[model samples]
Target chain A: MALTLETRDLTIRFGGHVAVNGVSCTFKPGELTAIVGPNGAGKTTYFNLISGQLRPTAGTIFFDGADITQLSAPLRTRAGLGRAFQLTNLFPNLSVEENVRLAVQAANGTHYDMLRPWMVRRDLIARADEILDRVALGNRRQVTATALSHGDQRKLEVALMIALEPKVFMFDEPTAGMSIDEVPVVLNLIAQLKQDASKIILLVEHKMDVVRSLADRIIVLHNGQLVADGKPAEVIASPIVQEAYLGVAPGRSAA
Target chain B: MMILSGDPPRSRVLSILLVVIILALAATPFLFPGAKAMNVAAQICIFAALVASYDLLLGYTGSVSFAHTMFYGIGSYAIAIALYSMGPVWAAVATGIAVGLPLAALLALAIGLFSLRVAAIFFAMVTLAVASAFQVLASQLSWLTGGEDGRSFQLPELLRPGTVLISKSLIGFELNGRVLTYYLVLIAAATMILCLLRVVNSPFGRVLQAIRENRFRAEALGFRTVFHLTYANCIAALVAAGAGMLNALWLRYAGPDTSLSFTIMLDILLMVVIGGMGTIYGAIIGASIFILAQNYLQALMGAASKAAADAGLPLLPGLLHPDRWLLWLGLLFIASVYFFPTGVVGRLRGAGSAKH
Candidate 1:
């Protein structure tokens, strides 16, 4: 199925607090949408909901015109909803290459082959090494995942996501904890991925510069509500986005 | 390397230790030459395989299942009941295995598929409850399982202990059915341990370790963690049952204390930790050392106590008393944990890496 993701009134509540309140949005193929929001604005929560990590209190998600709200996290991932965590979840003790190799093995469906030698999976190894090279982690292939620098770990996270080859790539704070020099490597990677015409990329990033440079469209979220959605310039220029996202007090006019 | 699925012990010291232990175990009947020695050798083989199987769950998969001994007990009890009711025949042992392996697999699947949906801790608790409940069920079901006294049955005619394989040999000991049984155990254990080595180094094992390290990442990579974990659980349970069958055959009996005891479970845990959590080689080293300690530590302590008392060393005599062996054992476990946090294998591997 071709990639088309839509959330119809996605809502989640923790007791009395509505973390993601009735967030209805549509994401199209061949476009990158940056979800911009302040702290605790449910941007990550929205991603979590779409990625099947959290169940919605009252909503439904559709992927390729099929209702997929009830699918589990793994089922959702298999259905091409690839997710990279905000906290950089990784196999800490495994070598860098082994970490990516696991993802490749998972994709190849050979992870269940109990008798096949893990190291002899040359196809998977080649693919994993290719990904490592792309992330500039080829030299550190033998290093354990936990020993990688923060930026390298982030790249490895992207490497893992790439290995899955999902239709809708969801990166939650992909550049968090990255140094300034390492930022372009990832941003460039994202730009290159944007060349694909059949994929939908959703990025949750706090940096407005990255949003301006890469986002084809921007969605502004405020206190669990989708306040503005449009081309990057129009949405960022809006008063509501400035007030809710830029931490400007709503009662006072934008000085 | 191919037999190990390309995963070696990775440390020269570890490799040498494993080779030495395996060689010593292989030659136990000829070199040791006593009933007690044969029993100890058989125990080392059985427990090595059993502990390796447990390591599949606890180490490779990062699962803590207390129900391991239940699967073991199932194997022992199945053999015991089959031989007692159907008569001591090869087919009875086959019947027992045919029944026990799949039964353990199914039970593991049921437990894993159901409880793994929750969390690792929940799975641990569920296994604990299931194991204890199974122990009770075995105790109550006297007709089939033989209850508290358990079931004592005969070995096959060829393994009847009195049957002599060799009347006289230069090798100092009579090669009888007992020796043959020890060899059978050694062969079976070696095969099982090697197979376990293969399993842990396979792509399946890679996924298991990945799941152990980070289940969420494994899932996001499109691997169904429940399926992988359940498969691992089933495999571990089968190996454990195989070990139990060997143990029952060697003892020519089956009992709760022998197979289903919680102490055995604790002992298995201790061996895994003392040996190394993630290495199958750790299982061989851990089980041999622990069983040897269990058997001879008291005697060693008795001698030490006598020397201390003769020297008038005050508290040293009381501390070194044979009955205080458990305290010394506890101290030994704590010291091992402190010194070798990753168990002996991990420590050796660290040394090998440092030299590089």
Candidate 2:
């Protein structure tokens, strides 16, 4: 099996503070990997490094054997790396289908035909609707993106990412603002996506239950350095991981 | 998949209405025998075209550029010089677009590169300064542009192919007279409107709309937005230059008043706003209102002056003078901004469920 995402000794410094320091990891295709830590643990910063949104102060990122540390965010996306933001970013004014169609259009390279009727293209619209259906948003296709519920907007954002048919998917706090009922739907969607053999899923999450339920492997960081990496149960059961979570358990920090 | 595709039912009606209006306008010289009325109508068509050109940038792309008149003047200068010194009217027309488009394109690229650092009023100011600088240059270079007086060119004949019979007519209208000028203007406006509609609906146009909504996200999506925006701006300038050349021919002279005037800019702006900022039909609707108001106000002011003397009342104030159409224009803008901020189309859309 080949690795979809591999970062070697990645270090990122913002001014005087080092946000991510000397972290090395390989995320394999078909694996659902979760990076979890307490607040200010730099999980998002690490994700940004791998997605090419941020340049590392040192080290390299190899995406499918190509060094992509210097590649732009969009080029990374074109190389089948997709990212979902902590805050939803979508065309708020356009219809939901129109938003999805834009992603489909991006992937298909139909960005210059002047006379072709965009919506009238049967196969493209079918593809768009299929993606929307994956996110359970088929009935709300015609509605403006701004009119949807909070949960639905999250789903729409995921649908947009899926429309790109990305090989590597990264989600940042996907369930941050969702209610209990909405959380399970998003959780299950990520789980379903992970089952595909060609897809690699990377998640930065905080909810303990969600991390254990979906992460095939778990990595923990403290103060921008990796502290633990293993199966979910092993990492969670580690004494250092327990100390990092419970805050200053006797003899752990001293050890 | 939702089977609904194509223009919604209302847009279909709008398309038909636009065709009928263009046809009626093409036939108007016969309906109204006065050359002066036809001349005014021809001028309106030119301004309407200018507004539509501006709409490509200001409306569709959401870039409110203030240097559009620079391209307008550039076109006028190119055509006037070409006609006087270099070539025939057709040659002059081509030169006008060629010179105007590349100049505007270069300027657009520069502005896009620099102006990304600032938006809204800062961008407007930068564009305004460029236009104002060009205005100053035009005034200083009296040898080429005739300064404030500007240059004059002979009106070029517009001909229909396959006939040199001089008085030959097309669809009952002569092709070699002033009436021919009107038809030419009509044809140009119709062609431009069709082309613009197609452009806005095309994939290229969708990218522009995406940039308008969110530039950062568009850039993140791998689109080189500055290049696309500059291209759009250049094309718009090319069309506006075409209109400018038509205006110079119709007027038989290109003056600072004709080319670089703030009044013309305001007229184009009003046309876009009153018609509906982002819609194609908005240009035509705004042009009609602008032309009608100017014509009607002047006539009404003349009648009022005569009537006032007859009734022995004081003369009308200069503020109310018909020549100062800007007063009414300012008021119209304020009202539009306050009441129907999206222009008349928004209200029309509101009459329905206000749903997208």
Candidate 3:
């Protein structure tokens, strides 16, 4: 069955401030939804809520028609919700290959087996290498994660997510720090992952061109609320986005 | 044979150093026949294993648990109590081990679940409190634990000093129970250390390190960080208990000063950091260096003081006095930390790798 996620009246509060006010939406498989909004518009907060990093003060999240509002982060990930941070979180001291290998090992479900050596698990290592090569990081597999450049670090993050192969792929900002040359590698990789008919992709991207080229649908968030939800062209042309997000006067045509 | 288990010391110099320590410890019963020498050697072996197990937590998993020695003391106390109460039978020793290990695991599981749900610091503080409480309880329960005096018990006939294994003497040293006890401790410590090496090199060990490196990433990758951390905690506890059993078997006694002291915990921290945090080989080197220095460095300083006095150097003798050995040891630790900030094993491995 295709994985579906729906949030109803999802809300979270920090010191009486509703960072993510009552905003609910449904996510379906085979749709790459680009969540566009201004800073602090509750896009990432919504992602965090769905990903189980922060508890919703007053709301419920559903996954595959099952309530997952209280599932822990790891449980959520195990249930096929994978999230990548915008800041490129990784095992900074581990070798790039080892980082991916660990993710693969984690997915393989041998975290409790202490007798067997990890080196003997050639399958996991091979799988990690395959993921690294796909992201063009095969050459730097031996390099420590902290030693990588910002762009390569971002690539490593994606490599780890790929290694997990979760059903729901959440990218906070995949190309947040990429230089022009590094942007395409990640964008192309996402495009490749978008090919799978059963995966649901959610992206919080600021670059409109990246969103337009990649997003199957766009949901505009403003002031902790879902202001608009529709196709990228309509949402971009929508007066709310045109005025609040693009900083253009409402009803103005694209320049 | 894969001498060093999972990862082979990585540096030839480190490998050589480890082999030397291993060979020396193995030969302690013969190479050093005197009682003092035998005791020191056994200590090196036991503390080496003990420190290495602690490294599994502090180094590999980045969890600082002060209750390590509490589990260790439990092992020692369990053996001591069993032997005292059950008449020094081999089954009693077996029973002690069988009972003590699970107890340690269960207590670790309990403490881990109770505190690991919170932050890392919370775990540290909770373990600290629990360890001290356990220590206090052990001391106060004079009826069961022998109170402040601790428990001194008889060993099985096979482990007694007078029980000669072979009448024939090899190079003047007889294969007796005393030697048997030393060898047993050595073998036990070495095997446990090797097992720890294997565990750390396992995929599970990798998960621990990944958790140490970045808990969020590990969690995001679908690893139950708390469960892994708690399992790691229990594994460390088991090995620590094994080390404590070796201590009891060799010394034939378990006391607050010998087994349950906070100083031993501090010593473990010192050994792990001075040896190298993440590397198991660091444990061997750290334990050997610390214990050997503790045993001999004071005398060495006394000699320097004598030489200085004989030379009539002003203020030199007083400054280098034997009583000031702690100051000297502190200075040496500072110097080691300064020169080998990553610890000796890390320095040695880094050098060997840099040449390539």
Top candidate by DockQ: 3
Docking class of 1: medium
Model 2 reproduces what portion of true contacts? 0.51
Q: Is the docking of candidate 3 incorrect, acceptable, medium or high quality?
A: high
* Chain B TM-score by candidate, in order shown: 0.97, 0.82, 0.97
Error of 2 at B190 (Å): 1.9
What lDDT does each candidate get? Answer: 0.91, 0.76, 0.90
lDDT of 2 by residue, B1-356 (tens): 12112433144444464556566677677777676678768877887788888998888888888877877887778777667665446777677667765766677668766774446567678888988998999999988888888887765455322233355354564444566666777788667766776677666777778878877555555556666676677777777777877777677678888888787888788778887877766777678777867777677766676676667676554445667665776686788767877766545545544454
Greater TM-score among 1 and 3 belongs to: 3
Chain A TM-score, each candidate: 0.96, 0.92, 0.98
- In CAPRI terms, where does candidate 2 land? medium
Can you write out model 1's per-residue Cα lDDT over A147-250, one digit (the tens) per residue? 99999999999999999888999989999989999999889989999999899999999998998999999998888999999998788777788788876765
Query: In candidate 1, what are the lDDT values of residues B84-168, reduced to their tens digit?
Result: 8889899999999999889999999999999997789999999999999999999999988889998999998889889987776
Candidate 2 clashes: the total is 0
Q: Candidate 3, TM-score vs. the true structure?
A: 0.97
Of 2 and 3, the candidate ranking higher by DockQ: 3
Q: Is candidate 2 or candidate 3 better by TM-score?
A: 3
For model 1, the stretches where C-alpha displacement exceeds 4 angstroms are A247-255, B169-173, B304-321
